[model samples]
Target chain A: MVESRRRSGRLASVPTSRNVKVSAGLVALFVVVVAAVAILVGGGDDGSDAPSERASSTTTTATSETSADAATLPPVVTDDPRLLGAPGSSGVTFTEFLDFECEGCRAAYPAVEELRKAYAGRVTFNIRYFPLPGHQNSRPAAIAVEAASQQGKLEEMYRRMFETQAEWGEKRESQAGTFRGFAEDLGLDMKRYDAAVADPATLRRVESDFAAGSALGVQGTPTFFVNERRIDPRSVDDLRNEIDAAIAGS
Target chain B: MTAAPAGTSSDAGVRRLGLVLLLAGILGLAASAELAIEKFRLLEDPLYVPPCTLGGAVDCGSVMTSDQASAFGFPNPFLGLAGFAGVLVAGLAVASGARPGRWFWLVVQAGMAFAVVFVHWLIFQGLYRVGALCPFCIAVWVATIPAFWYVTLHNLQDVAARPSRLGAVARIARENHGIVLTVWLLLVAALLVERFWAPWDSVFA
Candidate 1:
C-alpha cells in the first residue's frame, strides 16, 4: 500500500501542461454560474416600470442644470417639520428622510440630535416621513408622530420613538398600542390624538413626504441631504464634515 | 530503493502546500488585524466610522456594531489573529522541509474546517440579517475558503490511496481540486449577487 501510494504521489507531482485548459475551464465555469444565478434570481421580476421611473427621477434630481426651475430641483425641505434652525436661513440646511421604525434611523438618532444641538444656529435640520413598506409599524409610527405634531409634540414623540425602538421594532404585528402609549406618556389629549391618528389627511401628509423623498432618490431610511445635495455618510464624522463644509461654503 | 525519488516529489508537494498556507496566512492575518483595530476603535467611540465603510449596503460600521461581530464574547478577529499566526508558523516549518505526521495535518484540517463554517455563518448574517457587507470581513472570507479547500484536498490525497467508497469519492475530489475550488467560490459569489440584487441593479441602472 505504501509503495503504491509513493508511486501515485510521484505521478501526481509531475506538473501537467493543462494549466491553460484549466484557466479557460474555470473562466467558462464562472460565466455559466453567474448567468445561471442571474436567471434564477432575476426570474421573479415582472419587469416593473418602478425602477426605471426611480432611475430617471434620480438622474433629474441629481443634475444641476442651467435653468434654476423649481421642478428641476429636488424638494429638499417641503412643509416637513423642522427639528432645528429655520427655513430661508443663511446657514446650511440638513434634511433627513427617515422612518421611525428603522433600526438605522434609531441608531442615527443620537448623533443627529447631538449635531442639531452643536450646529443649532448654523445648520437647519428638517425631518421628512419616509415609512418603508417592510416595517409593519413604520407607517403607524409615522402617523403617531404626525399626530403628536398636531398637538405641538413632534420633537418629543420623535425622540420617544427612537429611544424605545428596540421594544417595538421588527415585530410582525402592529405596534399602534405602543405608539399610543407614547402619546399618552406625553400627556396628549387622547381624543384629539386618536382623531389625528385616524385622520386620512394625516396619512396623506406622511405619504406626500415619502413621495417627495422618492422623487429626490431617497431609497433607504435615514437618507441625508445637505444644502439639497445627497450625502452618503459612513460615520458621524462624515456627516459633521459635510455640515462644516456646507457652512463654510455658505 | 524507489523511496528516495518518491520522498523528493512528496517533499516538493509539501513545499508547494506550505507556500500556499504561508500566503493565505499572511492575507488572513492582515485582514484580521485590520478588523481588530477597527473593532477596538469603534468600541472606543460609537460614532467613529470605520475606514472600510462606503455607506449604503457596504457599510462596515453597521457590521462592526452588530452582535455577531463579537460572537464568543470577544471580537472574532482575535480568533483570526491567533489562528492565522499558527498557520503562518506551521507553513514556515513545513516549507523549510518539516515532514509533520498525520496528527499535524488533522489538527490543521480541523482548524480550517471551523474557519470555513464560521465564515459561511458570518456571510449568511451579513447578507440576510445584518443587511450590509464589511469589506474587511469579505477579505477574511476570501482568504479562508481557498485555504480550507486546499488543506482538505491535501488531506484527501492520503484518504484516496485507500480502497473504499469514501476513498473513491476522495480520489475524484482530489483529482478535480481546481474545479471544486472554483465552483465553491462561484457559489458564494452567486449568493452575494442574488442577495444584494436590488443594490446591484440600482448601480447598473
Candidate 2:
C-alpha cells in the first residue's frame, strides 16, 4: 500500500522538462503533417480566393460575347423553356441548372419563384434539366416537366413538381405514374401527354441539358448563372444581390 | 514528497477531469437533444427544412435523412443522450470527491473509446457519403473528442507506471497529451477541408 501510494505521488509530478521537449517535437511534427495535407489536398492551389478570381475572369470574358469568347462561354440558354421574361430581352439573363428531385432545388423554389415575380421583366429566367444520377426519380421528373412544356404548361408543372417534391422525391421506384397524374391534373390531352412523356426525344432533351450542365462545370443542382457567370449564392439575398448587380451592369 | 500534498494534487486532477466531463456532457447533451428534435420534426414533415440547413455543403436535412444517420436502426442521437447522461452522473460523482474503483475507470475508458470511434465514423459518413455537415452534429463531435482524449489520458497515467511496452507508450502519450489531442483535432479539420474544398473555395472565391 505504501509503495503504491509513492508511485501515485510520482505519477502526479513526472518532471516537466522531458514533457516540454516532447511537446515541442510533437508540435513540429504536426506542422509537417499540416503542410503535407495542405499540399496533397490543395493540389498547388494557393487559397480559396483562386476560384473567385477564375470566376471573375470568366465573367469578364463572357460579357464581351466576342466570337473568340463564344467557344469558352457555356450555352446558358438553348431552346430551354423560359420561366420568366422573353428571348432577346434587353434585361439580364439568368439561367439555373436544376434537378426536380434535389432538396436544395426544392428548398430554393420559393425564393426563385419570388425572384421571378419581383424581377419579372428585368431578368430572363430559364431552367435547364440536370437530373443527378443519385436521385432515382430526377430523370423521370425532368422528362415529365419536358412533356408538360410541350403543352405550354411548363411553368405550372414546374411549380407543381417543387410543391409535391416531398411526396415523390428520393423514392427508389420510378415516379412516372405520379408525374402522369400531375399531367392529368393540368388538364392536358392524355394521348399527347403520354406520347410526349414516352418520346425518346424528350429523354434526349433532358440528357442534352445534363450534358450542357456538365460541360459548364455544374456539379450540383440549382447552380445559377447570371449573364453567363456561375454564381454560388448561399441565400435568396445573395441571389437577389447578384441579379441586382447584373441589372446595374447591363 | 508528503502523501498529503501528493493526494491533494491527485484530487485536484480528478476534480479538473470531472469539470471537463461535466462541461462536455452538458454541451453534447444539448446538441444531441436538438438533433433528435430536428430529426423527429423531419420525420413528421418531409418538407420541413431544418434551421441549420444552410443549403449546399452545410445542409443538416440531407445528413439527417441519410441511411448512416440511423446506423443502429435508430437515430444516433439516442446513444448520445444516454451516454452523455451517464457522463454527467459520473462527473458529478467524481467532482464530489467520490474516488471510483478501477472497474469504474475501465468502464469510462471503454465507453470513451467507443464514442471516439463512433464519432469518427460519423464524421467520415458526413464528409464523404452524406456530403453535408450538421452544425449540431459538429458540436457533438467537438465535445466528444476532447472528453475521449482526456479520459483516455487519465487512464493512461495509471498504466504509465509499469515497465512494459504498453506502459512506455502510455507514458509518452500521457506526457504529450495536449499535443496529441491538438494533432488529432487538426487532422479531422484537415479531412473536412479536403472533402469540402470545392464549396469552400467557391464561397471565398
List interface RMSDs for the candidates, in order.
9.6, 9.9
Please state the error at residue B26 of candidate 1 in Å.
Answer: 1.5
- Residue lDDT tens for model 2, B107-193: 998998999899999998888666677789988998899888777767766567778888778766765565666677777887876
lDDT string, candidate 2, A133-242, tens digits:
66689899999999998888888899999999989976888899999999999998889999998899999999888777777777666688887788976446777888
Kept native contacts, as fractions per model, are: 0.10, 0.03
What are the Cα lDDT values of the candidates? Answer: 0.73, 0.72
What would the per-residue lDDT of candidate 1 be over residues B1-205, giving only the tens digit for each residue?
A: 0111211235555666777778778889999999999988766544466777653356676677666888898889999999999888887888788888888999999999999999999999888776667788988898888778777767777567778888778766665555566677777877876666655544444
Residue pairs in collision within model 2: A52-B205
Q: After superposition, how far is residue B98 of candidate 2 from its true place, in Å?
A: 7.0
Write model 1 residue lDDT over A184-226, tens digit each, in one string: 9999999999999999999998988887777776777678888
- For every prediction, compared with the true complex, DockQ reads 0.24, 0.14
Enumerate the chain B TM-scores of all models. Answer: 0.90, 0.91
What's the TM-score of each model vs. the native? 0.75, 0.58
**Which residue pairs overlap in candidate 1's backbone?**
none
